[model samples]
Target: MNERQFGPELTAEGASFRLWAPAARRVDVLLDKPHALRRGDDGWFSADVAGVKAGARYKFRIDDEIDVPDPASAFQPEDVSGPSEVIDHATYRWRSENWRGRPWPETVMLESHVGTFTRDGTYRAMIDRLDHLKTTGITALELMPVADFAGRRNWGYDGVLWYAPDSAYGRPDDLKALIDEAHLRGLMVFLDVVYNHFGPEGNYLGRYAPAFFTDAQTPWGSAIDYRVKQVRDFAIENALYWLRDYRFDGLRLDAVHAIAEPGETPLLGDLSRAVGKLADTTGRYIHLVLENDDNAAHLLDARQDFPRGKYRAQWNDDYHHAWHVLLTGEAHGYYRDYQHSPLRDIARALGSGFVYQGEASAHRDGRPRGEPSGELVPIAFVSFLQNHDQIGNRALGDRLETSANPRAMEAALAITLLAPMVPMLFMGEEWGSKAPFPFFCDFHGDLAEAVREGRRREFAGAYARYGDEIPDPLEVSTMQSAVLDWLSREQPPGRERLALIRKLLSIRQREIIPRLADAAFGRAHAEDGGLLMADWRLGDGTTLSLTANLSNQDMPLTAAHIKGTLIWGKELTASMAPWAVSWRIG
Candidate 1:
């Protein structure tokens, strides 16, 4: 591991505290009493607090005036406003000795938020549900951001502390135990990390070094100033800290487009190089996935000399938007461009890897967007029907089963899970849970009111158009409403939906996973009445054909030479019924 003197490091004799407060005239390490730190070169301060060890709670007094949490804190027991707790990451005994990380293609990502995944909303509570995911054929668990936010319950994207795990979901060891237990169950754990901008509240970096954030305006806030050496190193180190310290298999960088670093070597590029080196040193399969809205495919291209590229996959919002607009027939906001051609968009995304790819986008004011991604592999895109942003950001936080046409939703699930791209399932999506995953937070004072009013204003247009009632973001009931009813998975529509996903995923593993490595595989055909067919060329000379009628009316099959035993279908006839999804190995 790259040793950086920034946080509390415990030794046998005493604990050494270090912080970067270049602007401060004096810095002091405060545990029970104040111990003055000697200012070092380049604006760093250091102090060795005698008899202070792991489990010690401490804070740094900057300029002997402002008290703040450590920028590289490992655990924050009392939330972000409290002092940082020293944690010994090596104390926990891991049971994943025999486990090597799973391959990229074998990954079936289940994106979950710890706060609302269960009734308890704790890390240990999440461990009890791991067996269910394992039984459902999921290979990886992708957790949303867990860094310390301002309050008790949050979506985790509003995190300010880069190193500390949120105290609301148990301690640092509890999170480690969850990951350790997940690895023992043969599941890879991936964490969704936010490096674009810190949360609005409980952030103290600006107090110490304002250069940490740049003047560039992002959708969220000021972008990080990557041109500064310390800021760049800090971002890169945070990425490594998660992978190395927490034992997470991969990282999902949230919204890379919002990160504006206009330098020759951007923060993303430096992260790739550092992470790639860590993967080589540890001999572990570490991957980086991105949530870039711009459809930047060049990030995935690993040169012959450098194996690990910027990212392995990116969340394919184009595919989801196309599928969503087609299924619901509602195109507003960014979905406007897709209204013109939904099926064509889906076809292009399925075939060539990106729908825009330099084409003129009506949503972007007719500006040419995206780059050609035809040469990229299919797995370069991470496809999903319902993710956290798509569902939680909605007016009512309704699941696809309740919001869209039922049959269309089923057919959409079939295509999404069976597609060559890596498929991600929202928590409770497999069973079609009726619980609403609304946007909720527990902020105080003006911040809380701001969040509640902001959500109401954001969805005001949808409310006017569809008569939708936006949920109160500040209500405790809103957060409670998002919790999954685990018992519902065994009953009625949930059971049926669970069966469908299980069957499709099983078939995907047997039929699709083997052929995914082939660069020449995965082609698609779209027809009228929302009829779509995908063909995956096998190594031997046969084609794996999948047909689906996404419309509400029967559609005729046009393929003439499709002669093979039916793998999965409600009807094996000349014409497909409404919402009929079938697969054939020819």
Candidate 2:
């Protein structure tokens, strides 16, 4: 069959969809309603609902059973395989006339939940929110994964379908419209795509296509079979579809360590090459950002993973973990191994990456990480203080995590924004958002109870830090905790926090300080009290001096070797206090 005939092809009357169900004798288009489809001879059935308009919802009437929505639906409400909707991507009028993708080396990102970013969670509603982000000055926006997850009630993960946009947020056209609008507004949108495995509840792709999944088990479900030709093509094609068809800026791969393919050239490398080709063809910057914990430096090398590191970059979970544990002082689960989060860890992540590269680790069997340097591009790896997992996976799903005193939080923010690396801010982080960003999944009936029990068990093992009172991840309290106080932005504390964040971001975009640009640190001294990361130049250099006071009294700054412009903290200034950070453009 021709390429156009395969998968659902866009048509004058929205998009005409088809599925190969030779096993089934009949199939019908469950268009927003029911419409009997004319089954072709070769298991292909066609349905075109004209005038019904793009972004209109429908479901598949396979024989007589109504399941979930299409796995590849541009939008989903009933999760996966319930109903399918037709969305015309070409219709949205874009506005970002002056948008130029920030070279990743200079990437400064602001992450947000559409619902909490503004009073209204719709795509259009975020437009008003962008002005603040733009003024704050982060060049990019990383949306939490919005692939077709089940229900309108949870995080964008657990997405049953890899293609369909979830109906909970907005329709397909609405997402495209949002992207278009953001482009005009000059914000590059990076969509978090779950490719490691499908979500549990509403997934139904297997019933239609045989061999779509292999026995590769992940934290979620069986992983897609990339070794197989058809599945491989589908995975690659789906990415291409989104980039070329939907015009998205890039795809953020979630939990890439879970991707298991037996082939020589790994599926990840293949995807990277293909995505680059598609990006070239479209004359657009379509990139792949992998969320991997393997601490493999080759993934960042252009020629290592495939044709030189198949992906543009990998998310530095080490950076997140190291910095997070340092800031929160809560070491449970993987955080248990991070004993030394001295300024050196931040500096290494700032300059040469792969912190665990050939290093000994008790958490990972004492094996050294070896070598994680040589990928000499600054800001190639994204660094953040808080993310969905670090913040939401906790019993509280809290952002501030009790350690965010103004002095400490501000210092941490300076480290994140002023370092020689790409910075990402979690939703509501700019204004000290009280939103908890908890783990919220929708599981009805028996599965719901299973989820609750499972969540408790998961946290049970890590109860050493918070003690036994860990709240269940599935609790209603968890979900309610995630709601950001919309009024926080107007309060005095919120205003000050917001001002600090805005100023930091603005400096990241416009200012060029030595610490933000320095590659080598002349000296690094770590003490039980804290560490002083000093960047010394021949004449005058900057030192990103930060201290965290876990102890009762004030911790002193002892870096006299390097000099720079003093920005924050009372050690250097009478106004700031302990647990503070100062940036001097020495």
Candidate 3:
């Protein structure tokens, strides 16, 4: 097993504490007493203390001045700024030892936030909901980042301690139990990890190690200096820590486009390679997915015979944007890029992967976005209509169900679920819950006011229309409003929507998942009237076809010659009804 270069490592005698504080003249491990750490020429301070055991809480004292928690802390029991707890990774006994993980093609992900996923908002609380997900045909549970942040509540993006699972969600063992329970139920667990920038508060690295960040700025904060070897290792090790210790099946790298590593072998490549190496050693089917706005298709090019560093897939935002425009007709922000020809964009996304392949993006001030992604397989793109970013970033944090027509939303669901692309659903999307996933965080004083003002300022139009109604991101009520009403799945409209989703997924698993590995993009086209026709060659050399009329007006089915067994929707006639969708396989 590869031990982490940072934090405390448990030895037979006791524990060895290490800190990479190159800038600090002297460092001390503050346990029951202040034990001085010996600084090496390489700028690493190390102290092997006997009699120190797991559950011991300690902090690092730099130059007898500021005290900081371990950057690689395994557990932050109190919070981000509190003392770091030493955890023995080898202590936890595995219940699902034989679990190797499912193949990537079998992925039907449900992206969830732990805080809002259950009413209790703890890892242990999430275990009770596992059966619901498994029964709904969700093969993968993708969690938002859980790394220790400043407050009791957050979206997880503001994580500063990359290794520590937030104390708010329970202990490290509680998280392991969640993953263990998931694996036992034949569900793979994936974690979202942020490497772009640390959260705005409780980040003390700038005080001790300034080389960790660059002068370049991201939307969040200072860009990480990945060129520095130690900084690079921090990210890579953190990834390994989650997969190895927590037994997570996969990891979704959040916002790689924001990660400013301008080197030949960027952090993405290195991290992927390292993950691949771990998979090779452990004989596990681990996967790495990226959320890259650049639409860098090269990273997902499976044709490359490289043994390591090949990403399994990426979150296809273009797919969501196109559907969002067609469903809601909201031509604001990035939605403007797809509003002009949403149906055509949807067809392109369905058939050839990306809609804006090397095209000028008006939203980005006319700079061309994305590369040619037509050559990649459909499974290389993870498709979803609602995610944390799509819904939570909104001024009101309303779901598509609140704005889109019910019939049209059903059609969109059919397309997203049955298409060859790997599908994902937001937490409460399965039952069509109206709960809003408003962006919420726990910050105080000036920071809270800044976040409140920033949110209102960003959506000034929304504020003008519905001022004060927009949930405050810092308010406890805001987080409470986002909780999934589990009983809704059994209620009127919720039951109907859940049935539709279950039916769609059942068909997908039965018909599509069996032949998705070698599936290739075939062709797609949008007719004059809101009609979309697309087909793909499945792994077994069968054709899967989709015909959808997303517009409010009915349209004549010009390409009605689709000859396949009807998988969903009614048999096509001369004319298709508005919001009608059909899927077939032959």
Q: Which model scores highest in lDDT? A: 3
What are the per-residue Cα lDDT tens digits for candidate 3 across 1-586?
Answer: 2277988988888889999998999999999999999998678999989999999999999999999999999999889889999998888999999999988889999999999999999999999999999889899999999999999999999999999999999999999999999999999999999999999999999988999999999999999999999999999999898989898998999999998877547988889888888887888988889999999998895432221776889999999999999888789888999988998999889989998889999999999999998889888899999999999889888999998999998999999999999999999899998999989999999999999999989889634687878888998999999998889888999999999999999999999999997899999998877888899999999999888887789777655555799989999888888999999998
Question: Scored by Cα lDDT, where does model 1 land?
Answer: 0.83
Give per-residue CA lDDT, model 2, range 1-586, as digits (tens): 1243344556555657766554555677666567666778656577665656655676666558645455456665555655566656556665654443544445677777764455556777776677777777766788877777655666777876777766667767677777777777677888888777877777666676547788778877787777766567667777777776657777788887788877556877778887776656545655677788776666664222222336656677777776767666767667766755634565556546656777787776776653565344444567788888878777767676355566667777876777655678887788887767767766678878888777777766655366545655555565556666768878988889889888777665555432333333243344555544534232124334333333234655444522555554333532224555555554
- Candidates 2 and 3 compared: the better one by lDDT is 3
- TM-score of every model versus the real structure: 0.96, 0.84, 0.98
C-alpha root-mean-square deviation, candidate 2: 4.6
Per residue, candidate 1 scores C-alpha lDDT tens digits across 386-430 of: 999998878888877786878878878887888778999999998
lDDT of 3: 0.91
Error of 1 at 145 (Å): 0.3
Pairs of colliding residues, candidate 1: none
Alpha carbon deviation, residue 86, candidate 2 (Å):
1.9
Ranking by lDDT: 3, 1, 2
Better of 1 and 2 by lDDT: 1
RMSD of each: 2.0, 4.6, 1.4
Summing lDDT over every window of 10 consecutive residues in candidate 2, give the lowest-scoring window. Answer: 301-310
